[model samples]
Target: MFSTRPRDADAKQFIAEQKTLASIDQQVDAFHAAQPTAPDPVIIEHPIDPVLQTGDSQLLGGAMEIKSPWSEP
Candidate 1:
């Protein structure tokens, strides 16, 4: 009786939310479809030379100096 308008408004809001979700789903599907299908490389074939190899003069080897401007708690 008196609750008809509120019920209609709630239904309209629910439909609008569902439509927005559907649009987002469609956009996500389109983006996924546009991506390259080729399988990415998993392993590194060549060996890399280490920066802190053989002898380490300081603590954390070159990590602290490499990532300077850092704060310690």
Candidate 2:
């Protein structure tokens, strides 16, 4: 046995709160849409790190030589 006036008031209050949350969500989405996104990373053909290379590094002109402690000199 519930009164109709109180039920209507509660429904209206819930709808208003939901609309407020929806408005805040829309604002946040618009803010992110206005910001600029980062650029994609540069692609490399080989595993060489060009940024940290020096003059003594071997270029991609020929095959790289790997020397290990187990290999004879």
Off by over 4 Å in 2: 1-5, 46-73
Residue pairs in collision within model 2? none
Estimate every model's Cα lDDT from 0 to 1.
0.64, 0.70
Candidates in order, TM-scores: namely 0.46, 0.51
Q: Residue 14 in candidate 1 has what lDDT?
A: 99
Name model 1 segments beyond 4 Å from true. Answer: 1-5, 39-73
For every candidate in turn, the CA RMSD to the true structure comes to 11.4, 14.4
Residue 50 C-alpha lDDT in model 1: 65
Model 1 Cα lDDT, one tens digit per residue, 4-69: 467788989999999999999999999999997754444333333365444544333433222233
Clashes of 1: 0
What is the TM-score of candidate 1?
0.46
Q: What 10-residue stretch in candidate 2 is worst by lDDT? A: 62-71
